[model samples]
Target: MTLVSQSNEESTCERPTSKYAQYTGVLAATLAAFSIGTYLSWTSSALPLYNKNDTLSVSDQEGSWISSLVPLGAIPITIPAGMLADKFGRKRTIWAITVPLFLCWYIIAFAQSKIWIFLGRFVAGAACGAASVVVPMFTSEIAEQSIRGLLGTIFQLQITAGILFAYATAFTDNLHVIAILCSVAPALLLISFPFVPESPAWLVMQGRKNEANDVLKHFRGAHYRTETELTRLELQASEMREAKASIFDLRKYQKAICITLGLMIFQQLSGVNTLIFYAKKIFDDAGSTLSSSTSSVIVGAVQVVATYCSTILIERAGRKLLLFISVSVMATCMFTLSGYFHFQNSHDLSSVSWIPLLSFAVFIVIFSIGFGPIPWLMVGELFTNNVKSAASAATAICNWTLAFLVTKCFQDMVDLMGISSSFATFGVISLIGTVFVSTVVPETKGRSVEEIQIELYGTQISSIPRETDPEV
Candidate 1:
């Protein structure tokens, strides 16, 4: 059966499509991503404070748990989060993220013991996992096809901003103060997101044509042709319903599934999270001239700037190209870090102490531009509506599961194999990731969902002509 049918009639009068509402909605949805970013990076800054505080008295083992718990907490919730987004609607599922995020900070802000602190971190991670599944779906569904890549990249941008926020707040020695500050983004999201429109795609999936039309009109502005878009949405929705997709049906879309899951696996294996979760510690261990907090703040700022550059370049550079460059450079940086650590084990390299800081800065910059955002962005682009939820859940689960393994095992790997060997291991994995991107990954830049499917399956899924924007 055809996906979206072509329309015979053309509008004699065309009005300009305003993107302000779309941007507003996307910004609001991505606040959840921002909150999750803060939680992910919280350990980098907070762990040190935990050790210094006489009241908390957290050990190295407990610190690893705190850093790892976020991803660990995410695993079980990912499948349920996908189901919730599909069943309850993306906006509602996103709104629910604020509850756990607020509770996470609140619990940590007043915790009297290690148990309370661990509980808080896990709760925060639950919010992180849920947002990972829902925010991308919400943003992609609401965006105009022309600007969809940019909007999708914004989720990662906000996440970088959140990481920067967490690092910046590390200046305060008071952990309670940092927790309070981290709560601000979710609070703003809670206050502002209610004004944003729901996903038109989700509305259409529920057979609410009129409401979908209204949401489209709101997003696209008054002069936009809502009916034509609505027809396309309806057709796609009908196709999905006919497929009756479930988790068991995933084998039918194996290539897309493999690509998405492989990207996630490589993303974690590249050791980005190990650096993010322990940025301060890594710098301190490297014997950098800069203080650990200062080094982390610099890396965090670089991350934000690089991710911003990515939003501008994504559609122009294409996904595969960026991934290739990103992974290649990352592998190089990992090898460079390994060499630095090897020499440091044998000699006092105070003269060349800046190597670790410089290596990680370049690594974070390259990572933000390519590997950091593309996997998450592709998650929204790679699958059909029928299996999208299931694929996203499975992909997220793989991502967090690997993240947990790498972050939890990083120090152990260092102790067992030495820091140089540990970094060399990530370098090899990243080198393999470069090959995976070059050979296996498909480019989805500036393409509609149906066109992407046609490329993946080698069959034309729709007869509908792709909509064009002269303004683009």
Candidate 2:
């Protein structure tokens, strides 16, 4: 991507191109998501082990803390991670995540006591938190308008694969082996991530015009010139950087912020994480004939398959429609699970023991299709370059904070209120999520970042229509 001067509008150079050109940036971030998936699902497999005397004997309360601490540790780093992404560059901040991630696994692999384990999880949480904010920002910056949704959904696809990988480790009984194996993901990511170019948008924001052009050329290919997109990115960056927006100034974009905050909150409140973290326990309690580990593995496999299907469909189906469908189905699944649990709690239902497993499978599939990926994808789309880091950090912090509350209280809620009421509450939350997306979120399919910002801010008319050519 040679930065062209105003006078040199034409070049004789042949355009360098590849079929995979558009996926370069998101591919790097997907590697990091693999590591995060391991961390997120680690507690699921570890919980059953913790209760066994062969491993560290932990009470139910202590196990809940293990699962919840990741989010708690994440709250503090949310803003700092965003700042680092802005100051150092997205690639560097992302690579930096591997250090703590490495330490987390080694600590768990070698720890003699529960205190060391707690500390390990906290560090892992911090890394996961940082990655959550930076990966989306980087992926969003690099993806072109034409395939943005396809590239963006890669984040969740990698996450699902990671969870499936963790579940695969359950086949082995050794905790040390599982920890050591999972640790390799981050190590692999750290070594390979540098080969990918830095985000062109970030380079432009830093006033490194020539480097930004080079990145654009690399990602966009030799045939496509960077002139139009580069100019727009520079203009957008200049406006955002010049404004000197702070976290507090986010209030100015009231509706956008509300949407960001709402998605983050609703994403967790839907009980996806709670179900994931307790997949084994939930399956075990449901009186299913299949072993708890086998049931949990099935759920993980379904998530990966479902996310892959969504990755293919997201570009075609449009964000709003997929979200509406995902949330509506998810609500119905929640109610189904609630009914199953209600029946079990109130009377003998030995004849229909399979309802929970079937219900969970349906819920996981529907959730993957939309609610799983779109919320994070939008985090990258909704904000301008200048405020993107700050706004995403705030949203990520809210996400983790709420996640902490839900994970910590989930088991207790189940014990006190019964699984029926607990799932019923999530069912209602899923219904609300449907309403929020249907009414508030706009269709961002096939629109440029500038166009999306213009439409949401209502500041000016954009040429982008409701419908656009897929190739454009």
Candidate 3:
């Protein structure tokens, strides 16, 4: 199938009258991500309360389960969530996410037993998993190509904001109160998101061309050329439909699948989550002047700020450049941290106690800019409509599974190999990730879906631009 030429399309279309509608819809949909962030990080604060036997007594083993269950719960629902997004539409699947999110908080707020707590964490994880797939898809579809990167990055920004919100609220130390507060994110989404338009791309895919035209007008503003945009979407949808792709057809999408999965693999193996999961312990072990709680808060704040910076820079610096810089600097910080730990094992480290905290803060900042958000953003950018859902599901599963494995094994690696060696290993992996980004990952900045698909498939659509060097 032929694709529309970007230059011709742009020449035909008028500038959007306003971007406020797109911004508002993204804000509304990403509330689910905000809710997921609170759930993912909730254990950092709530697990301590559980262990204290104040509200409900939880054994150390049970606390571990409660903390890990979110990713574990995410695994089972991710594929199904992707399927639902493709079948019912991204907005509907996102709306369905509220059920588990609400149930999660309700169960946690009223729980009298550890089983109830476990169930609560699991369902919260399910919602997190589902949102991971649907939110990016929804945002990507509704966004104009010019600002898609900025909008896609907002998903990660909301997640970081939610994490910081959870960290900030830990001072309350009231499990029920925190649960109730976290529930407000989803509650707001439930109230506001219904007013937002369904994805025009999905509407086009479903052959609802008139509705897609109307929705495009809503997102792009009345002055925008809805017919031109709709025609492009129609061609893409028809091509994908004629391909009739299934899970078995994924072999045809190996390049995208591999690129996406590789990014997810490197994202987890870079040890960002290891640092997040064990931040307090790492801070305490290093004997930082700042309290572990204070350090955790500072790190969370940095993450939010840095991810916000990513949204600003992504459209400017481009994805591959950011990934390369992010991983390279992250590798340096990891090695620096490893040296500190190695020295600590042998020498008094009071004078350089600041090194660990500094290293962690810098590592988190760099990570938030590149490895943390780009992987997810690309999940929405890299694939065609036919295989996008499967690819996203596979990417989410890879990410969560690696997250669980890394988090679970990190302590064991520290015990067996020493903290120094464990961090150095992560450093080596991150160093390798830099090479991967430079060699394999393509830059998606300022590219449309058809342009990206042409690069991935090596199909020469006469109307579409040919792939060029990322540097160019």
Candidate with the greatest TM-score versus the true structure = 1
lDDT of each: 0.86, 0.82, 0.82
Top model by lDDT, which number? 1
- Please provide TM-scores, in order, for all candidate models, with all chains considered together: 0.88, 0.85, 0.84
Q: Per-residue CA lDDT of candidate 2, range 408-452, in tens?
A: 999899879988899999999989998899889988888777777
Which regions of candidate 3 fall more than 4 Å away from where they truly are?
Answer: 1-14, 54-60, 222-225, 253-256, 318-321, 342-346, 377-386, 414-418, 435-472
**How would you encode candidate 1's per-residue C-alpha lDDT over 1-472 as one tens digit per residue?**
1322222223422232698999999998888889988998988888888878897888877888888999999888988887788798888888888878877898998999999988988888888988887888898889888888778788888999999999888889778999999999999999898888789999998988889988888998877788777888888888877875667767667777889888998889999999999998888889899898899999999999998997777767999999999999999999999999899978989999989989999999999889887887787787766667677678778999999999899878987998899999999999999899989999998887777877887764333232343542
User: Against the correct fold, how does model 2 do in TM-score?
Assistant: 0.85
Error (Å) of candidate 1 at residue 378 is 4.4
Question: What is the model-wide C-alpha lDDT for candidate 2?
Answer: 0.82
- Count clashing pairs, candidate 2: 3
lDDT of 3 at 449: 75
